[model samples]
Structures are given as C-alpha cells and as structure tokens.
Target chain A: MKDRLEIVASGFGGQGVVRLGQTLGEAAVKQGLRVTMLKSHGTEMRGGYVRSQVVLSQKAIDSPMCETPDVFLALSSSAYNRFKDTVPAEGIIVYDPAFVEEIDASLPCRQIAVPAKDIAVRNFKRPIFSNAVALGSLAKLLETMLEKNVVLESFLEVIPKYKDENRNAFEMGYETMNI
Target chain B: MKRFLETGNFAITEGAILGGCRFFCGYPITPATELAEAMSLRLPQVNGVYLQAEDECAAMHLCIGASLGGMKSMTATSGPGFILYADPYGWALGCEAPMVVMNSGRVGPVSGITGAPGQGEFYLTRYPTQGGNFETITLAPNSAQECLKIIVEAFYLSERLRMPITVLGDQLLTDGMEDISVPENDDEMKEMGLRVWPRLYHKGPDFYPASDALDIPPVQMGYDTGALCSDWTPTVEGYDIEEVEEHHKHAYRLIYKVRNNPQLYEDFYEKKYMDDDPDLVVVSYGTPSRVVNTAVERARSEGLKVGALRLINLWPFPDRHFSRKTKYLVVELNWDGQLVREVQRAAPKDAEVKFLGCCGDLPTIPDLMETFTKMLKNQPLERKGWVLEAW
Candidate 1:
C-alpha cells in the first residue's frame, strides 16, 4: 500500500458522491488506516455540485485537501472537466459515461468509462444502485490496497436497505472493472 | 476506547458530556447547527438537557441560567449568531458565570457564506462583549479529535476561571469527518490526557472576591449560599455596586484571574522545527494550521529553514512564542489580517512580520510552498488585484 492515498468523488448533489467517499473511508477505517473525509456542497442541495475528498494514510494525515488525487471518481461532466487535469500520469479517473459523455482525451491520466447508471438500470431497474456499482469498480481498483470483501461489507453497512441488490451491484461493478 | 469516523460536532458533543456539561442551549446556524443537533440527540441519553432558544442572545442567557442553577452548561453558534451573543456574553463575564460557548466560524461579516470556513472572529472572540473590563478564554482546535480534547479543556477552564469560555472553530473543522477515539471510562480519559473539573457551588457570603485566584467555585443561585448575580457591577457579597473601587475590584478579578494564571493555558500551543531557531516561523491557528504544518514539513524537506507555531489557546495571545526575533508569516482564513496584527504587536521591533490571508477555504499547499520559497529568497511578495494581499 502507498504511504498516502487521496481519492476525490464529485458529482451532482443526489448522485451519492459524498456517500461513495464515506463508504471508502469507512472501509479504510475498518482496515485500521488513518482517514479524513471532507464533504462540501454548493448552496442548493439537489442540483448543485457536491464534492467529497477522502485521504487515507498509514501515518498521520497533514493536509486533507486533495490537490492531486490518486483516484478521481467523476459522476458528472462538469466534475470530470474541472478535475481532469489534477490527476497525475500514474493516477486513474473512473467516470460514469451516462453523465460524462464528452471526455478529455488529451489528459495523461488513465480514464476508464464505467457505465454504472446503465448497468444499474438494466439489472436493478433503479438508478440509485449506481453508486454501489461505482463503489464496486473502485473496490477492484483499490483491491491491492483494500480488501474487496471489506469494501463490499462497508458498502452494505452504509446502505443497508437493499443488501442483496447492493451486493450484486457491487460484484457487477467489480467485474466490469476487472482489474 | 471507542473509535469511530465522525464529524467534529459529534466529538464535541461527547467531550461536553464527559466534561460534565449537562445543559446545552443554542440557536441553530449552519456549521454549528449540527453540534446543537448532536447535543439534542445525546444529552437526553445522558440525563442532560438540550434547548433550542429563540435567538443566540437568549441561548447564551439560557446557558448562564443553567450554570447559575448548578449545572455545567454550553451554547454554540456561527459568526452571525455569535454577534447576537454580545449582550449575554457581557452578563456571563461580569457575573462570572461558568459556561462554554462555541463559535464555529463561517465566512462572514454577516452570513457571508454559511457553509464555508473563515477566521473573521479572531478579534471578536477576545472582545465578545460590549465592555472591555473582563477577559475571555478562547481555544481553537484544528481537527475533529483536537476539538474533543479542547472542549473538555474549555469546560475545565471555565469552571476554574468562573467565566464563559469560548471554543472557537471553523466550518471545516466542525463539519469535516475524521477517525476519532473517545474514552469509554474515566481511566481511559485520564490515559488520553483529558482532565475534568467538577462544578462546585461557592459557599459564600463573599462570592465576588477581589483577589486574582483560581478554583474559586462559581455562585449557584438555587443553593442557600445567598448568591446574588446581576448585570450591574458586583460587590464583594454579590450586590449591585457603582463605586469606582468596587468596579475596579470586580474588573481586576475578571481580567487578572485569567491573565495571572497563564501557566494553566500557556503551554496550549504546538511548535515544530523551532529548536534550532529557523529563519522563518509560520504562525497560524484552526484548520489552516493543518495545511501550514504540511507545507512547513515539505519546505523543511526541500532544505528551507522554516518552523511552525500553532496556537491552540487563542486569547491572552501567546506573546512569549513571538519573542524570537525571526521572520514571521501569519496565515489566516480571512481577507483581513486579524492574527497577523497580533503577531506584529507581539514580535520584537526589529523582527519582520507578514500575512497571507484567504477565506471560505483552506490555502492550497502549492500556494503556500511558493510563498515560502519567495519569503526565503527575500523576493517581494505580490498580490493579484484583491484576491489575497501580503504585508
């Protein structure tokens, strides 16, 4: 595992952006990693943009701001466009193609298109489970650093209403990434 | 010890309960509203009282009433709500009411930005009330975990000082989430270096003492101690007095009780890389100091002789830390340089003091690193338009 890992998730208010970050942070905490999560939203709660910056470290975390995120989860086009440049060459950008149709092809970072919305709608018939799908892909990407089962357990713990659906959605997401 | 990933508001609520705060009266404001909500949810389980007042003034007054009735009390608000606390703040100070007031500062002259963090209240906390005769004790914690410890310390100080103590925080500190460990019992609390002072009723015919002392229990009205308290200048026996000498005695006790007992809170600061007297000292408080620590550490790695001084005890302004005749840079979360002014006043005449001010957010590390580089190279620090100016 890296000494410090910075993950940022940004999208519209209702896209479960903050929840995604919180789930990852909770998993990191269960793994005994020092974690700090900062969530910020615009004036409006629904339509406005929301962001959550999560920093996980083996040691004490000094700066919580994700100036350069190791992993960038973009659920909205604007978020994809705004933060595309902050990802270093070795960093990865996981974006939902449903919201981010136009991608920045010139960026040095590796960009993966995860059609979470389409997959969730096709399988579960509800777009709300897209977040679970997204977390699954993130879990696969962070498998080397975090345990897949732990991440899945934390996701289920965070959104406990539909445990079976979320588990399936998470597995689908992990399979989609296939890292 | 119980560990959980939670917001600073949750940590503060637990801290207040551990410190014997059984009553909380607050006016809901963004950033601080969550703290009140947490109190409302948890206070009842602990057999404590949580009240939502009509306004901030009424809220602080209610806390004063609770404290007078022999209960450790607390109140919280943001910048806008804290402005309304001027009336009761003076009353609490003059009557020597032991309570805790938390101002989770948001970007504002008046509700400038409800959700964003700012440090506009650096001076407002020192002079929270109208009259300047009394001194106020204020603690600023940078993170959620520190917020827990500081709130507990604030309660301890309030009881000993016999005045309303302010725990100053910012939006980010109160609203941000982090992994926090809370003590499960008194043994664990002591193992974690946490202290708690019980609320003691003054068995007094002379409740208002003229001397500057510590651990003098505050007057409890419900008891048969005949404790008298009011907005007026208090006499030795807690009566209304307008005489200059009696007012002098009251003022001295209010101011000197804290000023004279600097040893209690003087060590409430963090110093990094200052042992060998580095060329530059970065001074800051609250959330911004976290970034400053990182930036300073990075600068040191790059061979820059820089140090960091983080003030946890904000009021009584730790001047002793500024005695070193070195270049000082004060970073704050406000456009106007409030803390920078204090550093200038406290530093030696020959020492150079500068300011880097930002609001509504923490300063980026790259910006801080570039500034440190420029300051070390003796380059002129420039400001773009009105974004952020340097002194």
Candidate 2:
C-alpha cells in the first residue's frame, strides 16, 4: 500500500477549512514528513465554499493538488453534497451532525458524525473554535501523521489569545472521537 | 527580530532585506503600494534609502540611476504605473544597468479595479522594450513563497547578467497571504555572490574608469559633470560627431552580449515528457503552468499521451529548444491569447498552434483542465477578441 495520505477539508467560508488543512500539514512537517497543502476560496469573503487538500507522504511531493481524497471532512450540507462523490470508496467521511443531515449511505465509506458546532459555542464559548475541534478530531483519526498534543500546540501557536477555550475544544473533539 | 505575523507585503520587505536591495524608489499604486510602504518603514532600520518619486517614470529612472551608482536598487508599480515607466525602462535596457522592478499587476487597460488581479499586460511585457536585439528577463511568480525566491534570483541574475530584471506578479500572489521561512541574515545572500554590485572597475595603476560610453559606470546624483552625456556620439573626452560609428558599435556589442547570455529557465518538467515524440504539447507559464501540469498527469493516467512545456523566462523565447518532432501546440495564457502568436512563430510551420485563452482576472485550475480536456479530444479552440483573431 502507498504511504501517502490525502485529506480534503471542505466547508463554507469562515469555517476554518484552510486553517485545518494547514494545521495538519504543519503537524506532519513537525513529524518529519513531506507535506503539500492546496486551498481554493471564492470571491466573497463569507458563506462561500472553501476547501483545502493536504497530502502527507514519506517522499517528496510531486504534485500539491489532490485528485482523490482519502479522508473527506464536510462541515456544511452544501459542501457534503457537492464533494461527496469525490471521496474514494475506502476512505472515511466525517461531517458536522448539526449542519449536514443527509449523507449517501450507499457509498462504500465509513462515516463519523460529531456535534462540532455546538461543542465549540457551548464548551469553548467561541463558535469559530469549531474548526479547531474538527481539526483535533481529524488528528485523532489520522493517527499515523499527527498527535493530539501536536495539533493542540499548533492551534495555540495560531490562536494564543484563546488558549484555554481552544484547549477545551480540543479535548471535546478528542473525547468525541473516542480513540 | 519581532515574531509578528507577516502579510505578503511584509514578506516582500523581508525579501528586499535579504536580497541586499540598498535603495528603493517608487510611486504608490494599489496592490504594489504596500511594498513601497513596507520598504519605507523597514529600509531605514537596515540603513537603506527609500524614496517616493513624483511618478512611476521618475521612480524607474531613479532606480536605474541608483543601480548605475553601484547600489542594489528596486521599484514597485502596477499596470498604469508600468506604462509611465516604459521610456526609462527602455533606457535602462540600452544602458545595461542591473536593477529589479516588482510589478504587482491589477485589472487594467487604463485604470481598472485597484484591488482585483489581472494578467492583461502579458503582450506588453513580451514586446521588446528598446526595439533592439536586447531581451528583458521576466520572472512570473505564482505564490507568495515563490515571490521571495524570485526576488533573490532576480537580483543575482540582474547583477551577473548586467541587465534589468522584472518580477511579474498579479494581485493574487502579491496580495495573498502565506507562511514562509525567512533567511536569518545576509550571509546566505553574500554567499550567492549577489552583493558584488559595486564591481571593481580597476586593478592597479593602469586604471580605466567605468564610463557610460565604454564601461557603464555608477554615477551619483551630483557627480562629475563630464560623466553625463546625452549625445549619440562617443568621444574619448567629450561628445563629438566623428565617433558616432564607435557609439553604434558599442551599443550593438552590449545588446548582442545579453542576447548571447539568456537567463536560467526552470523548465517545470524534464525531457522525458517533452521528448521529440510527443502526441500533443500544452504550453503555459506562471501559475497556470502548474495547473496544466496537473491536468497532463491526470490525462496521462487515463492513457492519453500528452505533455506540457512551461516557460520560467518569457523573453528570449527559447528558440533553440523547439524541434520538428513536436506535434499539436496549445498555448494557454491568462490574457486574450497574447503569447500564442510568439509560440506559433517559434514552432514549425506545419505544426498546428491553438490558443486556449482567458481574461477573467484569474483563471482557476478546473477551468484550465476543462479547456485542455476538450482540446485533447480534437475539439476546436475558442478565440477571445479582435487582437488575438488578427494574429
């Protein structure tokens, strides 16, 4: 089997999709793995589809763009419906249960539904921290490339002002994963 | 060093510092104005001089003068500002002064959107600046990270080749944000041998001063009056009509010397892909080239024998590399097929050169793939405007 793992984090604008991909890429880099991150954003600043693809590999990354995603994270219903077909059959699809209600169960892929938004606003007191929560859960699932503490530290480095709330969000995400 | 988060503007400032740019002169233009603003704030800390000229013309002239004065100098501007500096830029090309100009292009024919990105200046850039045998080295960077690398290389190439170098970027690359690792000090820069700006003009007692007539000397603002000359004739001590032939010969020599020594091109792929026996070749440059490469790889996986050729240097056109074995040629550019004519001229007459063009300010990877996929299936290509159609 190939040692490369392709992860695509997609959601509406301001949902921190790009940041989540960047954090995972940074974590992989800290672990001595080659990483490439590609992101696309819409013209509008808010409420548009934002997606980022992160490729983690042991060898040099030949191309940064991802043709097929191994782990697909969809934070919005529109994003899930739009990109669900691009997910590989053997891959995993993670969705925010609060927003994404319907996922095609016919596709041969594992699914994980988590209350990512409610946990962020209620436990962390910041709805924006939901991205960090999603990222923490992703780090736990992709156990080979990243560690929970490493993702938490990367989040803290980027969001130093809200360290305690971010920590709580990370813990909630990690516990939700039940890893 | 303060660990504050840096934007693309500040990253360019850091690049200028690392590139040993001792002087900066510019007039404000959107997208590129931040580069000047950051230089004004940071250059003083490094003991470098920064000046705001009356306009882009004066800005480019000041930069050329500073470079001639044995200092590493630069300037920044957008499309409208770039048009104003055309005359002085031609002068710099004729004089072979080493300098760098960062053009953060925005939407424009005259003055379009100040904030949006545009690649409309592709043809203007490829056109010969001085109407002679000279070639200007232009580097198009796609991302902010490439912006820093290209700036450093631009300085090195300009000094080593003794010609004006341009870093062509759009509002996307210039205004976009990304994380980059800045070099610690100028030691790495010095090791690159780029700091040899004030080149030694003499060795021992037998000294020949650097002159604009023979040696292209560095001249300060208020230097010796004898060093300045606007006359077309070359005289030993002063201007004279009898030495007109000598001046023409010297100018031809400078132009031909640069034509002989072209800049280094980072061909995106190896010859295995661009070998003599390719079914079809898709040609692109800058960020779009990256997307084309991806599409080519995808097509290859599906059993389509296709290849791509990307140009790191748009000028000098790499005439030596084109061969007869190459088949269909498709030119993909952001402008309305600006570079297609040049590509057609460079290829064999029998070769069919097609244009897959766009002028939508920014062309995405998917858009390019869609167009390429259709072309590979033998579909007719779309033409953009009267200009491309005329060709």
Candidate 3:
C-alpha cells in the first residue's frame, strides 16, 4: 500500500458522488487511518458539476485537495474529461461506460470500464444502486490499502435502507472489475 | 475517544453542546446552514433550545437575549448574513453578552458565491460592527477536528471575557469532512484541551463595572440582582449614562478586558520549521493554511528555507509571531489581500512581505512551491494582469 492514497469521484449532482466518498472515508476511519474528504457542487440540485476528493493516509493528511489521484472514479463524461489527466501513469481510472461514452486512449494510466449503471438497472431495477457497484469496484482496486469486508460494512452502514440488494450489487461490481 | 468521518459543522455542533451552549439562535445560510441544522437537532436532544430567527440580525439578537438570560448562546452565518449581524453584534458587545458567533465565510463583497470558500472577512471579523472601541476574539481552526476544540474554547473565552467571541471558518473548513474524534466523557474532553466556563450571573447592583476585569460574570436577567442590559453607554450601577467619563469607562472595559488578557488565546497558533528562523515564513489562517503547511513541508524536503505560521487565534493579530525580520508571504482565499496587510504592518520594517491571493478555491501546492522558489531566489512573481504590489 502507498503511504498516502488519493481517490477522486466526480459526476453530475444526485449521483451519490459525495455519498461514495463518504462511505470510503468512513471505512478508512474505521480502519484507524486519517482521512479527509472534500465535496464541491454547483448551485443547481441536479445536472450540475459535483466532485468529491478523498485522501487517506496512515499519518496526518495535510492537503485535502487531490492533485494527483491514485484512483479516479469518473462517473460522467465531463468528469472523465476533466480529471483524466490527473491520474499518474501508475494510477487507475475506473469509469462507467454508460456515462463516459468516449475514453481518452492516449492516457498512460490504465482505464477500465465498469457498467455500473447497467448492472444496477439489470439487477436492482434502479440507478441509485450504481454507487454501490462503483464502491465494490473501488474496494477491489483498493484491496491492498483497505479491507473489502470493512468497506462493505461501512457502505451498508452509510446507506442502511437497502441491505441484500446493495450487497449483491457490490459483489457484482467487485466481480466485474478487471483487477 | 469516538472517531467518525464528519463535517466541521457536525464537530462544531457537538463542541458547542460540550461547551455548555444550551441555547442557539441562527438563520440558515449556505455553508453555515448545516451548523444551525445540526444545532437544531442536537440541542433538543440535550434539553437545550434551538431557534430559527427571521434573519441574521434577529438571530444574533436572539442569541444575545438568551445570553443575557444566563444561557451560553451561539449563532452561525455566512458572509452575507454576517453583514446583517452588525447591529446585534454591536449590541452584544456593548451589553457584554457572553455568546459565540460563527462566520463560515464564502466568496463575497456581498454574496459573491454561496458555496465556495473565501477569506474576505479577515478584517471584517476584527471590526465586525461599526464604531470599534473593543477588541474581538476570533479563532480560525484549520481542520474539522480542531474546529471542535476551537468552538469549545470560544465559548469558554466568551464567558471569561464577558463578550461575544467569533469563530471564523470558510466553506471548505465547515463543510469538508474528516476523521474527527469526539470525546466520550469529561475526562476525554479535558484530555483534548477543551475548556468550559459555566454561565455565571453577576450578583450585583454594579453590573457594569468600570474596571477591566477577567471573569466578571455577565449581567443576567430574571436574577433580580438589579443587573441592567442595554446598548447605551452604561454607568457602573447599570443606568443609561451619556457623560464622556462614563462612556470612557465602559469602552475601556470593553477594549482592555481582551487586550490585557492575551494569555487566554495568545497560544492559539502553530509554527512549523520556525525555530531555526527559515529565510521565508508563510503566514495564513483558516482552510488556506492547510495547503500552506503541506507546501512548506514539501519545500523543506527540497532544501528550501521556508516555514509556516498558522494563526488559530486571529484577533489581537498575534503580532508577536511576526516580530522576526524575514521574507513573509501571506496566502489567503481572497484576491484583495486582507491578511497580507496585517502581516505587512506587524512584520519588521525592513522585512519583505508578499501576497498570493485566490478566491473561490484553494491554492494548489505546485503554485505555492513555485512561488517559494521565486521568493527564495529574489525573483518577482509576475502573474499576468495581477498588480502584485506590496501589501
């Protein structure tokens, strides 16, 4: 595991971008790691730009702004275009193909496509659980730094309403990831 | 200690409750609105009172009223709402009401941006209300965990100083989430350096004392102690007085009580790599200082002589930290350079001072590193279309 892990998730509003970051941050805190999560959103409630920057470290985190994210979760085309270059050559960019139709092939970082929205719709019949799918993929990617069961438990604790569906969606996401 | 990833607003709400703030009256505004919402939910669970006022002025006035009635009171607002607090803020100051006012600042001359952070209120907090004959106590904590301790300390200081204390935060600090460990009991609270001064009503016919004293219990209503609370210049016995000598005594107490009692908050600052006297000192407060600290640490690793001076206690200026003659750079979240002027005034006459200003967003580390390199080499920072003049 790296000394510091930076995870950035950006999409339009109401996409649970902040919630995704919060769940990961909660899991990191439960693991006794220092974490900082900063969420910025546009004025409108929906369809406005939204971004969540989460930084986790074993020691104190000085800068909350994720300048170079170890993992970039691009949930939308605009988000993918905006932060694609911020991922270093060794980092990974996990993007949802439903929102990010086009990918930047010239980027040095490994770009993986996760059909979170389609998987959520096919299984849960709702796009709201797409965040769970995304988290599952992130959990698989961050296996070295975070415990998968701990992340799942924290995710359930944050979104407590759906238990079985979220768990299934998470497992599906974890299975779908190329990692 | 119980750890949770929470926003600064949540931490501050718990801090206020732990600090014996039983009453909170505030109007909702962006960034600071969540604080009032948290207070509304948490205050009732602890058998406290939460009121949503019609406006910012009424909210602060209600807090003042609750404070006068022997309750540790508080209010929260953003920059635009804070301007409306000018009237009640002065009233609380003149009446010596013990309360806490939190200004979670956003970009604004007047409501420029509702959701973004700004440090335009650096000077506004010092001179919050018109006709400044008093010294204001404002604490700017850099993180969510520190916000809890700072709010608790603010409530403690307000009671001891017998005046309103301000907790200045920006949107990022108040709304950002981090791992915050809340105390489970009084022992834990004490271990975290949190202090709480119970609201004490003065048992006196002389509620308005002429002497500049610390821990003089504020005048509380319904005590039947002949205590008077008014905005007018008050006599020693709590009568409305117009004589210059009486006003002078009242003003003297208002000013010197905080100025003379610097020990209460003088230690509220952080110095990194400053013992050996680095060639450059980066001075800042609030959320911006977090990035500055990171940049300074990185600069030191690269063999650059740079230090960071972060002020938690913003008012009374903490001029002692700037007594050294060195190249100083003041970074803030405003383009107009408010805190830079104070650094220029407080630093030695021959010391070089500069300003790096950005609004609506935090300054990037690369920008800070580049600027540090320039300042160390004695090269001018030439950003196109920027004046870059001396503060």
Each prediction's whole-model lDDT (CA) = 0.90, 0.67, 0.91
lDDT of 1 by residue, A1-179 (tens): 88889999999999888888889988998999899998877667787988899999999888889889999999999999888999999999999999998988999989999999999999999999999999999999999888999998888888889999999999999999954
Docking band of candidate 2: incorrect
RMSD to the true structure for each prediction, in A, is: 1.5, 5.8, 1.4
- Grade the docking of candidate 3: medium
- Measured with C-alpha atoms, the lDDT of residue A94 in candidate 1 is 98
Candidate 1 DockQ, CA atoms: 0.71
State in Å the error of residue B208, model 2.
15
Question: How well is each residue in B1-391 modelled by candidate 3, as lDDT tens digits?
Answer: 8898999999999999998899999899889888999999999999999999999999999999999888999999999999999999999999999899999988888878776889988888999999878889999999999999999999989988888999999999988999999997888998888874456778776788887788788888776676667778978787777788889998999999998989999999999999889999999999889899999999999999999999999998988998988999999998889999889889999999998999798999999999999999999887645675554
User: What DockQ score does model 2 reach against the true complex?
Assistant: 0.11
Instruction: Identify the runs in model 1 with alpha carbons over 4 angstroms from their true place.
Output: B384-390
Residue B290 shift from truth in candidate 3, angstroms? 1.3
Output the better candidate (1/2) by lDDT.
1
Report the lDDT tens digits of candidate 2 across residue range B225-342. 3433232433434333435466665466455555655535434123326654567777766555555676677677777677877665666566655565454444443555666777
Ten-residue region with minimum lDDT total, candidate 1 chain B: B382-391
What TM-score goes with each of the models? Answer: 0.97, 0.74, 0.97
| Model 1 whole-model lDDT (C-alpha atoms) | 0.90
